[model samples]
Target: MKTYHGSCHCGAVKFRIVSPEITSGVRCNCSICQRKGALMTPHIYSPDDLVIESGEDQLSVYQFGTGVAKHYFCKVCGIYPFHQTMRKAGYYRVNVGCLEGVEPLQLQVEVFDGKRL
Candidate 1:
């Protein structure tokens, strides 16, 4: 596992999560995802694997569709940094774009058919 530090645009929310190898991230064609244009790295992590370094109160939550995944973003910056995937039995999916010094577009991407739902 590798550690990645992430934060919102305005640096209001900062966090770290352990990811496996991180060769790729998921690009879902779902309505919300398409609108947000976020490259998601849905790493399977136990709740303890994530550490919120600061700005917990600056975050806001959004949910849609089946309301399974709870997307968390910074209220001030409006950046989706991570989400709790209820569809995957309750694991966290961190937004690799928010990670420090990481170029999300350089990673291999697997597309999911979320629009079919």
Candidate 2:
């Protein structure tokens, strides 16, 4: 697995995800996700696979509905980079677009009916 580095726009929050270069990511049609334009790579890793290299304190979280999914962003830049999964403790859905040098459009996207779930 290749280790990829990512950070918020302002560089306040930085993290790493160990995985193959992504060929696809999950694109949820849920209300909030659609509105925020967040294209996530769901279940890419357990929490153990993600390492916050710096600015842990700069991260903020948002949740709604069941509140099981915890969306994490940089408090300083307001950039959404990842979220904790709803069903799996310590598993994360990462923002592929936020991964350094990743092209969001290049990812083959799978659509999830998150609104219906």
Candidate 3:
């Protein structure tokens, strides 16, 4: 597994995720995701595979609907770097934009039927 680095707009809330260089992305139609315009790869990883480099207290979480998924954002910049979905507990949906040295269009994106969920 290759490791990639990512951070929020303000350089706070940095993290790293281990995954392959090529990834499958996910596009969700959920209300918050749509508003945030999140285009992400569903690189689900165990908590051990993810490292929160800094600003642990600066992270904030939001939940809606069944309040199952925990959407985590940087409190300073309010950027949703990653989130935990109820459908896949103990794993996180890492935002593709957050990953360094990655081009958005290069990823193979799959539309998630979040609206029907």
**On residues 1-117, what C-alpha lDDT tens digit does candidate 2 reach at each position?**
788898888999889998876777888888888988878874558777899999999999888888888889898989998888766755888888788878888878899887886
Candidate 1 Cα misplacement greater than 4 A, ranges: none
lDDT by candidate, in order shown:
0.84, 0.84, 0.84
Q: After superposition, how far is residue 5 of candidate 3 from its true place, in Å?
A: 0.6
lDDT (tens digit, per residue) of candidate 1 on 56-101:
9998988877888888989997999888875674678888899986
Clash totals for all candidate models: 0, 1, 0
Model 1 steric clash pairs: none
Q: List TM-score per model, in order.
A: 0.89, 0.91, 0.91
Summarize candidate 3's per-residue lDDT along 34-84 as a digit string, tens digits.
888888776677898878999889999988888888899999998889988
Clashing pairs in 3: none
Structure candidate 2, residue pairs in collision: 47-90
Stretches of candidate 3 exceeding 4 Å from the true structure: none
**Candidate 3 at residue 20, lDDT?**
71
Candidate 1 lDDT score relative to the true structure = 0.84
